[model samples]
Every structure is written in structure tokens, then in C-alpha cells.
Target chain A: MVRVVLCNCPPEDANRLARQLVEERLAACVNVIPGVTSFYMWDDELCEDQEHTLLIKTTEERYPELSRRLAELHPYSVPEDIALDSARVAAAYHSWVHETLSDT
Target chain B: MVRVVLCNCPPEDANRLARQLVEERLAACVNVIPGVTSFYMWDDELCEDQEHTLLIKTTEERYPELSRRLAELHPYSVPEDIALDSARVAAAYHSWVHETLSDT
Candidate 1:
């Protein structure tokens, strides 16, 4: 099973985390997207921020450890870790992602 | 059944598409992320492009029509429409997405 863990963070933090995740093999790839204008509600008020989002690709088996490591490394007190199901990855691509994982 | 339809396009195209999707109720929300450097092989040659991605939030029921609309509006002959499952959406958020759709 494949999943893409999504999180929005400061651009500097996002870049650092993406590199670390890939280097550690917690993620096969981490696509860092900059210049995101997010408008969401926090504390009953509308808040807008400029944030970068990381789309980290990994297998289901590694998610727990990945999430743990991400929490520890994240700057925010409660960092977002939304795992969306990559329900239909191509066989070759799926195999490549698994093969890249150090723990696999 | 929440899904985030992912697609990459030119920054200007992405911005216009995001607004159109939301305004048309094909998507409850659309996040436009710019500054994406994508490297991929097409027709046996490696190609790289600076693109913007749209993360469009919608429900499963509307996906077929949304896809049809997307195909009609997208510039490319075959624009990518990767629908990743938002498997663990909050109750309020999920309901809101469904409720926002005009067809619902």
C-alpha cells in the first residue's frame, strides 16, 4: 500500500525535512512545493499564511515510524501528518518505492 | 469518500482552474501550489518543467462529472487526474465537501 504524507510547513523547514526524509529512506521521494497561500480557520478566526507543502511518498508499513520521526523533527507543537492513500500506483513505481526503503 | 484530485499545469493555468473548480462546485476547495520542478520521462526522453499543482478536494459521487469537466477544460490532450483518497477526513470537513457540491 502506498501513501503520500502531506504537511504544510515553513519553506525552510519544509526543504530541510524533505531532504532528511529521503536520505533516511523514510520516504522514497519528497516533493517540496513552495509558494502556497493557505486560508484556514484557527481559534475561531480566519488565518492566511504562506507555507510550503511536502508530499512525501512512502509505503504503509513505514508510516508509523515515519510519523514518529516527523513529529520529533517538526518545529510546530502539532505538525500536520495527513496520509492520503495512493490507491493505484503502477507496479514498477510501487516496487521501486519499496526497494528504496532501508527497512524493507 | 473524499479524494484530492492532483494535477500539474502552468502557474497561470493552475490559478484559473482552481477558481473555476471551486466556483462550479466541482471542488469544495482547491489549493494551488507553485514552484514545482517536475522531472519525468515522456516518450523515452527525460524532461523537466517548472509547474504548479492543484490539490482539489471533492467527493466520490461527483468525480465522474468533475473529471469530464476537467478534461474539457484542461489544456493538455491528457491532463493528469490523480485522485488520492483522503481516507481519514474529519466528520465536519467530509460533510462540508459533499454539501458544497451543486449536484449533491
Candidate 2:
């Protein structure tokens, strides 16, 4: 029931997005990983860029809104927003995530 | 199916583990994210530590070996090895990942 969403953005936008997501209750916590080099294809051309990756943690129920808001706020026209379902989560950490998001 | 495995380790071991996993073919690529502050509970106590998070990209079929090798090489007695199943991936990137691991 937990989802960790992966998103890569420019380094300048990293902290702003992370703070907004957590503040808006769209995510319980957001971990920003800086200076990641991502290599992928865009328009049939290989592209590589330095980015800051955001690890957004939220529950299944909040994911839809989180995804929507992320798209609306993201700088890119089509940002990478991939959700990964956690196979196993530590009980305490899981509880904390739920509680933090629910304590609205 | 593609999976993104999350593992947190000390800063000193990040590049070594990332390179080892990729070189050993357990993972197609590993992104090292430095200076992650993780707040979790261990032994009924709250612990906050700075860690380097490794975003390991691999196939579901190759996960067992990756997990085993990660545990063996990690410095922590009980390391965090959480696998998240990628709900969706870009076609080109996904193909590249599969091909990279399969070429061995």
C-alpha cells in the first residue's frame, strides 16, 4: 500500500519541490539526492544530464493527487514520474509515514 | 519487469558498491546519491544518520543475486535492501537495462 515515487529534476528545483510536497501532504517525506547523471533517449537521441532525484514517499491513496500536483508543479514539459511499489517496508518506518501524512 | 532497489550505506562505500554491482552484472546501472539523511527506528531508538543512497537498476530475474551480493558487500550488519517494482518505465531505457544485464 506504500509507493515510492521517483522523479529527477534540475538541482535548483530540488529543495523547493521537496518542501512543497511534504508541506502539501502529497508526500510524507521527500529525500533529495543531488548530482545524479541520468542517461536516456529523448526524441531518438541519447541525452545525458545532471539532475537531482527526489524520492517521494506516500501511501497508495495519496498517490493520484501527488502525481497530479507533481506534474503541475514540475518544470519539465514531461517529467519522469515513476512509482515503485515497495515489496517490503520496515514496520516502524511505514507507520511513521502513514502517521505523518494522516495527521493533517 | 524492472526493479529499482534502494540501499543506504556509508558515504565511503557508495562508489565501490555501485561499481561492483554494475561490473558484476548484478545491476545494469547504479546511481549513487550522496548525503541522504535517513530518520528511522532501530532497537527501539530513533536514529538519524547520513547515508549515500544507491538507486540500483536491474531486472526482477537478477534481483536475488543482487540482493545477496549487496548484503555480502555492505558494511552495515543489517543493511536496508528494499526493492521497489517499477510500475512503468520508458521503453528505450527499459530495453537498455535488460540488454545490459542479458549481454553477460
Candidate 3:
């Protein structure tokens, strides 16, 4: 089954990362979402501002490689990268993801 | 914990559903991503076209309610609503999710 990862990055850097992911074909599809307001405490100060979110589509076999690549490319000291198995998805869509990635 | 659902919808009706979800508080935050191209089979025929993706953020307590509401409001007979628990997240962010939603 294809594994899914949900990630959020600063708006300034999100686009570049998305480009890299696509250029590498680490994800069959990378959805870039702008204007996401994220609220969290950074350095003991509560902050809320616009950011970008990425929906990365890849297979479980490629997850470790993808995660490593993301970590190397990510700018944040601690980036948000959460991977979970997709329980319900169109069968056709799942097949597409598997077909899109290179053999791991 | 906040349950995450990754859903894709026909672009024409994505915004309306997003609005409904926000108004209903099914998701504390709903991101509407435009210009998504989806390829799949409908009625045994291959179809490929643009669509929109939604990143719904809500607590686990509301997953069932949100799924039910989405089904009712969704135009598609088989709407895509998949919930998965986040494996890695900032502690502060996790708390924010819990605080965002009302009890259950």
C-alpha cells in the first residue's frame, strides 16, 4: 500500500521544497497549499501566521528514502513530517501512486 | 489527537464543501488547494482532469461526526474521507488541536 505523509513548511520555503520533491519524483503528486495559518509556540512565544502545507504521495517502500531526503532538504531544525497509511482511497488512485514511483 | 483526512474533490464543488466544513466546524482548518489533476476510472472508462484537494484538520473525537457530515454534504455518491493519526508533531501543535474543538 502507498504511504502518505503530511507536512507543513514556512511559506517562504515551501515552494522550493515542493519543486525539489517533484524534480526528484519522490512523490507522484505534491499538492502545495498556500495561506495556511499555523499557530504554535516557537522560542517560548506563541505565533500565528500564514504558511504552506504539502500533501506528499508515495509508497511505503520509498518512505524512508523520502524522509531522509526531506530532512536533508528541509530548513527547519524540526520540521513537521508525519507518515500514516491511507486506509480509504480510490483503488485506481492507489495504483497510480504505486506506478508513479521508481522501484525501491 | 487531531485526525487528518486527505480528500480530493471535483474543482467545481470543492469550495462549497470547504465552506460547509468550516461553518460546521468539522475541521478547525480546511485548506483548499486548486489545480489538482486527478486520473482514475469512472464507469470502467479512464478519466483525467483537474480537481481540488482538501486538508481537513480536526480532532479524533470528531472523526465520525465529520465523516457523516461530509457524506451528507458531499455531492459525490462515494466521497473520500480517510482519517489517520499523526505520528510526529510538535507538542504545542498537538495541544492546539485538542483545544480547538469542543468536547466530542
TM-score of B-chain for each predicted structure, in order: 0.92, 0.93, 0.88
Candidate closest to the true structure, highest lDDT = 2
By TM-score, is 1 or 3 better?
1
Residue A84 Cα positional deviation in candidate 2, in Å, after optimal superposition: 2.8
Q: For all the candidates, what are their Cα RMSDs to the real structure?
A: 5.8, 6.4, 7.1
Per-residue lDDT of B104 in model 1: 34
TM, chain A, every candidate: 0.92, 0.93, 0.88
Listed per model in order, the count of residue pairs whose N, CA or C atoms clash below 3 Å is 0, 0, 0
- Candidate 3 C-alpha error for residue B14, in Å: 1.9
- Candidate 2 CAPRI grade: incorrect
lDDT per model vs. reference: 0.76, 0.81, 0.72
lDDT of 3 by residue, A38-84 (tens): 54434434345556888788777777777878878987665666676
Model 1 clashing residue pairs (backbone) = none
Fraction of true contacts retained by every candidate, in order, equals 0.38, 0.33, 0.26
Report the Cα interface RMSD of each model, rounded to 1 decimal. 4.5, 4.7, 5.6
DockQ versus reference, model 1 = 0.24
Tens digits of per-residue lDDT, candidate 1, B1-104, equal 67778888876688677767766677766677878888988899999988887877777877888899999888889898998776554344455556667443
Regions of model 2 farther than 4 Å from truth? A1-33, A37-50, A54-82, A85-104
True lDDT of residue B18, candidate 1 = 72
DockQ winner, 1 or 3: 1
Candidate 1, superposed: residue stretches over 4 Å from native: A1-33, A38-51, A54-82, A86-104, B102-104
Q: After superposition, how far is residue A64 of candidate 2 from its true place, in Å?
A: 14
